[model samples]
Target: MEYVKGKPYFCYCDGKIKQYRYLDKDIKCEILIIGGGIDGAIANYYLSKDFNVVLVDKGRLGMSCTACATALLEYQLDDFAEDLLKHMTEGEIVLAYKMGIDAKGKINNFIKTQGNYCNFALRPTFLYTNSFFSIKSIKKEYEFRIKNGFNCKIFDSNNSPFTFPLKCGIYAENGGGEFNPYLFTKQMIENSKNQNSIFENTNIVQLIKNDHGYIAVANFGEKIYCEKVIIATGFNWEVLGIDDLCERFITYSIVTSPLKDFTWFNKALIHDVESPYHYLRTLPDGRIIYGGEDTIFKEKPINENVSNKKYDKLEKDLFRLFPEIEGETKIEYKFCGCFGSTPNNLGLIGESKIDDDILLFISCGANGIINAMAGVDVIKDILLRKNNPLIPLFSP
Candidate 1:
């Protein structure tokens, strides 16, 4: 898939930091990771700690979907827990929610270990509903989360954030945060450099399964022999014939110039109950990044006119939510990227049904960063030949 168009702010901020040499020789390792995005980096970080690992990407690392990501590290799934209960048993739903929540903590801990280099900041999240009819459902969701001992509080319109038309809102404490995804991916790769080999501009053209393991042939005919192979290519997993696992869509986002007066409520990560909900966050430098005008994926190149219309909608919505910064804000960046959506809003992680020696760690959904963090532990346990309890929860 054509992952992104327009300048992704994070990429621009980081500039061209470093470059890796392309692969020119065949290599052998205990584990081979294809794709140098966030998932691949996380996998490399854990697997390299104890085994020989090789990570390769067709292009620059973290320049694809990872760079374009909004990077909201929240445990709140796109599908609420109360709604999931309609399809799954209470125990199943609770476990899934707990896993998501635990993923947030894991992410925090991992960031801490890395010296919090990714602009990691713990913040509150507000899931609100503007419609009166939606209030009851939102209240039910709030009650369900609270009943499960989650940190949540319900607020009526009278006490909700100013400028937000809220009938009710769920203020979740210690469940969400934001980070610089591009930096996180790069740091992970750098941290693993000692124990792992990274090959850039090397495409794995074919995979051959042998009796003992798998052989991945690169574009230049350089083969990688490994006991296990992992695919973390995001929406482009069609190269591995697993694109059908999740539906793809396009989402737009805009980053504004530093505002003179930031009037947003506590600068908390804010989202709504509406479909294609608008999400907004404030950077430390006083800039606001807002995203969420999503549509079904189309195979055409990014059209400037279409992108402008989407940006207009996003800008208009931003003004409606926070009219205080109307004239003061100027959009500095606008971009659109393909986002993979799963049925249950949880990431897909496990061994491939068709290929036994191959593992899949596709983080599909809004909680992708957190899911990827969770997946690191799961994949590590699998490599160690230990049973991961999350296998059944996030199974492919």
Candidate 2:
């Protein structure tokens, strides 16, 4: 049923949709997708071209972490080069850099050709810190990027936009980009739907053994059968019996009212070396999103109420960047979200040992956009490594 008559709802918050009970029914599909997150959307895109597909969402599509996100799209993960390099070996660092670079193409290909309305913007990206040692090391990082074929430049505190401290900022040479993740992800979901099968506002309760493949037991004991299953339901793995993932909280985010464009910032994504390490960037509509309040409790966050602490911290953080905003616009909306993480900080993409052909996961920290695309191709090629040249490089 088309939802035109359906009242408009903000699925970003909990209790937005009616509690759906799964109807017990016998249904079949070649592939069943459990989560409606970005990774699930991308996986559905690839599989829809060939296999029969059925996608179920516990929450509205594209409105979970993807909507609540700070939405800064950068190749660099939480740690900047200076610190990340220390933890990584030579070959590992090279592969990591190459993987991020390759993710760029997978995400931007449609933007380059299909003219997607997803706010794809080109801006400069910078990393800065208060320590003199950290400031001087950016130059070394710039040198490393150039030596390794990445185009980068260095700017000292005196030479950079913010006048806070002594370190230099490593410019990403127009590599930084941002977009409306909700809109882009929603478009993909729409394209993934076909006449064969679809169910929304549906919640899967359990997974059980079945004769053909697997049986997804929804809330009301409804049975949906599929030959395979992929779990892209961000932060909801517990419902599907993945319990160990419930404790990992990788990062958090917040968005502020649009700030006046400045020649100083040069409209690029920014990350700094603070206690919680602030990462900031601009949305297409001019809002500035800065987050990374790291180092805290590990328990799952109970954020049913808006965080006054996060709001107050954001104000103080941005005031350091734009004193103008301190007296002007206040934070209009705020939400706290956490993602899954591992010790190595790389995505875990492959088969599940628990059940046969019953799982795939998108475990990258926040590189969902590009990683999702690359993962779709990798999952497809996993069964053909002997014949395919690129298969061994990404094999499980």
Tens-digit per-residue lDDT, 195-287, candidate 1: 338988999988898876989999889999999999888878755865577788888999999987674666678887787777888886789
Model 2 TM: 0.83
Q: After superposition, how far is residue 390 of candidate 2 from its true place, in Å?
A: 8.7
C-alpha RMSD for every candidate: 1.7, 5.2
In terms of lDDT, model 2 sits at 0.61
Error of 1 at 226 (Å): 1.1
Candidates in order have lDDT scores of 0.81, 0.61
Worst 10 residues of 1 by lDDT: 11-20
TM-score of 1: 0.95
For each candidate in turn, the TM-score is 0.95, 0.83
